[model samples]
Target: METLMAVVIGVLFACAIYMMLRRSIVKLVIGLIILSNAANLLIFTVAGMTRGAPPLIPEGLYAPSGIVADPLPQALILTAIVISFGVLAFSVVLIHRAYEVVGTDDLDQMKDTDT
Candidate 1:
């Protein structure tokens, strides 16, 4: 399972990098989302795969006879998702504004407008 996650992370990283290099704002935003998901997967897999229950335990702090997931990685993924969502939303608004003001999606032309 870890190996599978590693492969998924690698593929997501590659696609994210490729999209990040593109000239459009939408692709860049997608790249950012993919990068976040890759990071989340990497964090989860590297923490070890545990199956049984949620990190939250009502049976007390002790092991209590069940294998539970590591809470840290879960929290990390949640924070990452929240941050990525905010970033994605902001990017969408920014992209719309850019499109309205510049009339084009090309980064090269956006840069050339100053000169």
Candidate 2:
């Protein structure tokens, strides 16, 4: 499963890079979304996959016993998700405004207006 996830993450990264290099502003946003997802997956994968109980210590114990799930990666992923959503939202609004002002979605066309 880990190997499969690694492969999937690699594929996503490649796709994201490809999309980001396109001439369309919309594709760049799409690539950013994909890149964020890939990063989340990478964090999850690096943290190791284990079926275990929550990382809660029992009463009188200083630490969790037996196989316990790690919470750090979960927290990191959650934070990343929130951050990515905000960035995606901002990008969408920015793209819409750019389209309205520049009247084009092609990045090449946008570059031509930099006179």
Candidate 3:
């Protein structure tokens, strides 16, 4: 499962990089989204996958018994998701305004208007 997840993450990262290299503003935004998702997946995969109990410890126990899932990765992923959503929302709005002003979504064409 870990191997499969690693492969999927690699593919996502490659695709995101490829999209980011495109000349279209829309594709850049999409790439940012994919990259964020890949990052989240990486954190998840690196933290390891356990089918054991949750990170909760019994009242009488000082530590959790058996294999317990790490809570840090889940917390980090949740934070990343919220941050990514905000960034994506801002990027979309910025792109929309840029499109309205520049009248084009092509980065090459946008460069020409800078003068």
Clash counts for all predictions: 0, 0, 0
Candidate 3 positional error at 76, Å: 0.3
Instruction: For candidate 3, list the clashing residue pairs, or say none.
Output: none
Q: Per-residue lDDT tens digits of candidate 1, residues 16-89?
A: 99999999878888899899999989988988887757756465565545676678888888998999899889
Candidate 3: stretches off by over 4 Å: none
Error in Å for residue 105 of model 1: 1.1
Best by TM-score: 2
Q: In model 1, which regions exceed 4 Å deviation?
A: 55-63
Error of 3 at 91 (Å): 0.2
Candidate 2, 91: how far from true, in Å?
Answer: 0.6
lDDT per model, in order? 0.86, 0.96, 0.96
Report RMSD (Å) for each prediction in the order shown.
2.2, 1.1, 1.1
The sequence of per-residue lDDT tens digits that candidate 3 reaches over residues 12-46 is 99999999999999999999999999999999999
Decide which is better by TM-score, 1 or 3: 3
